[model samples]
Target: MRFGSIRVRLTAWYLMMLALGLGVFGVGSWFAMRASVFHAIEEELADRIRDVKTFLQDQTPFRSKIDIRDELSEHSVLGLGGDLFQICDEQGGWLYRSSALESGLVPIRLPSQVGDQPVYENLTVRGAPVRFATARVVIEGHPYTIQVAEPLEEFYEALERFGLMLWISVPLLLIGAGLGGYLISRRALKPVDLITTAAESISINNLADRLEVPKTSDELQRLSETLNRMLSRLDISVQKMSQLTADASHELRAPVSLIRTTAELAVHEARTNTEYHGDMMQILAEAERTSRLIDSLLLLARADAGEGGLQHELTDVSTSIREAMEQGWSLAAGKRIELTANLNSNPIVVRGDGEALRRLSFILIENAIKYTPEGGRVHVRLEGSHAVVTIEVTDSGIGIVESDQPHIFDRFWRADKVRSRSIGGAGLGLSIARWIVDQHHGSIEVQSQPGQGSTFTVKIPLAEIPAPLGQP
Candidate 1:
């Protein structure tokens, strides 16, 4: 039982207890039956002895020992089955014997020193088992002994039957007990087995499994709920990481492509001062774009790695717009496009980093100038209110598709692929512009349709008013 598992141990203990009870009951019953049988036989023997002694005292004066022996023999034959009686002298010599035993079946070597010292014994006499008791007597100034012997077959038969019953019933009880123990153990462990099965069915990649728990509000049910919650968090975090990776790759593609194209074009050139200057400028332009793209990517990486957002100050929207127009003037004029600025007269201030806000405005104006056809108009406006300030760039150009407008702020996104290729710059303007604006608690949006010029609006909270207008 100790060597096996819990079920086996429990079964063994129960069976052993049953076996012990049966053994004790069988032994007790055997002894009880033997005692009862011996007590009844001895009681009968004692009664008969009293009767025979009384008759002997009442005998006539002419009665002899032989006559008395004949009388005892007759009584012994009448009281048959398991009793025997005999009369003997004090010197241990027999005078009369019962008819229950033949001459060769009597016990030999009777006790000589008998004075009520429990002269009773069980022994096989000649070929049969017997229980004998002896007592001393004095008659006519001489000593004599009386012995009583009983056959043991009745007692032996009763004990033997009890033992047989015990042997038969014990095995059957053990079988029943074994089956009962197995059923109980299985019922008790059913919950554990179910939990194990649930765990085994779940996959690491698809960790959407759940236990079929009972509504008892048990520990097992709580465990299942906790595991499900953990899986939900894991799925969310994995999705976010996947999105970040995809966005980074998309953002990196444009600059890499621009650098590749510029290098290729510079290499496939002939010697001429103007051509060489153009090639060098093109290469420098692409190099600077690549460098700025890389810088923006690094900033995003830092933010994702728990770094804080951009450093900010109270900056004027008009100043940023005017600077952006100046920088983008050449590009706008190169396409014969008209650039107009409707900036506020007062110092219209918003909370932002000056350099970042200026870059954002430049990106928007550049987009407007690049897409507008000859003689097209591009309007840049800066407006301020107590709540927020807005820098808006509106262009008369090959406008964005409504479908493409939704993704215009995405990294490396180009509304018109062929136009973007001819422009010779990475299509990261709107993406970086949006990033910078977002860092300053600002929002950028696009409103456009196919062949209907686009407008880019940027709004930021007026966290602090600008100082009185000052020249840069």
Candidate 2:
């Protein structure tokens, strides 16, 4: 009766279908029985009419009318047990009547032009149901009408019993069917209840808990699997968020503490101008470092939020590579490290944002110079074909260990935290570079061995060739 529940609605639909099927069956059964019963009655009446006609034809021709009448009387007396016979002239003058008729002068409807072919009808005789057949016969060229009737009491009694049974059994069958449908619906929807309970029990703290998958490979099973996968992803994201918060707090605290300590020292004592100027310079340096870190963090935040997409254009990637190498030459000179660039002759045209590509180029070259020691060598190479462009930056520096290679591009990640801090970095350059390369539909890969060297390679798709002039 609760229409909102799927179980109840399903059961209702099942019972409605059952009711329709049973109703059709019941009606067909009733009609079939009625036809069978009437056919038997009509056949019986036909047989009786044929027998009476033959009897009349066999009478002697020499007998007087009274003798014939006596013969008819004897014939009528012989017929009994629900059978009745009537003999009359075509003028409706009765010659004989059977004991089955309660009155001798009973009027029965008859066809206006009776023939040898018998006709059957259902009638009422003295308020009792009867089936009768009428036939016209010729005896010595004299026409007579004969009628044979049988009481329908037994046939009607059987029909009434069948009808009563149908009325009684149909409701009982429907009730049993309704109950069966409800039970089946309830069993089928039990999994939905389990899923609801599991969902209700889960919270942010218990997101690792998953719904129990059923054994059957059905829609419900797929649903449970999908939900479990979603929960797994959420758990990973939450862990990353917590780690980023902790790392950001630590990085920010260092610079802020330094700036505050230097300012406090300068104010606490009357120092010489030289000492005061040194404190001011140190404070300015820490402030600038903090500002750069914050900027990098904000840039990454915007990228993650899908703020800016790559502004694609036909760009020569070799130009950016040469520029980045030139920039690195200065930094490498200060560190006493050798810098090298091997640029290809042909232009490596790619579809990407020019500024983003330039930034990507600088980050890789700079990262190599920062990590490599004095007297080490850094190599930058640009090579291209018709289909793809490749950029490789190799350095004979303190290489990353295999364990730390996978997480190198993660935000705030550092393989050697102390060394990275001493070298002045917030660990966001490589992450941002990776993001830009990805935006351009490219890939960046790194290969390194501890204490030997490191190589970073980038591959980007080439732009399409332009059509020749006047070839529309």
Q: Indicate which candidate wins on TM-score.
A: 2
| Candidate lDDT values, in order | 0.71, 0.83
Residue-level lDDT tens digits of model 2 in 185-213: 78877888898899889888898789898
Misplaced by over 4 Å in model 1 are 1-282, 306-309, 464-472
lDDT value, candidate 1, whole model: 0.71
**Per-model TM against the reference:** 0.46, 0.81
lDDT per residue (tens digit) for residues 406-468 in model 1: 788765567666767667544667767877877878789988755769899898888754457
Worst 10 residues of 1 by lDDT: 109-118
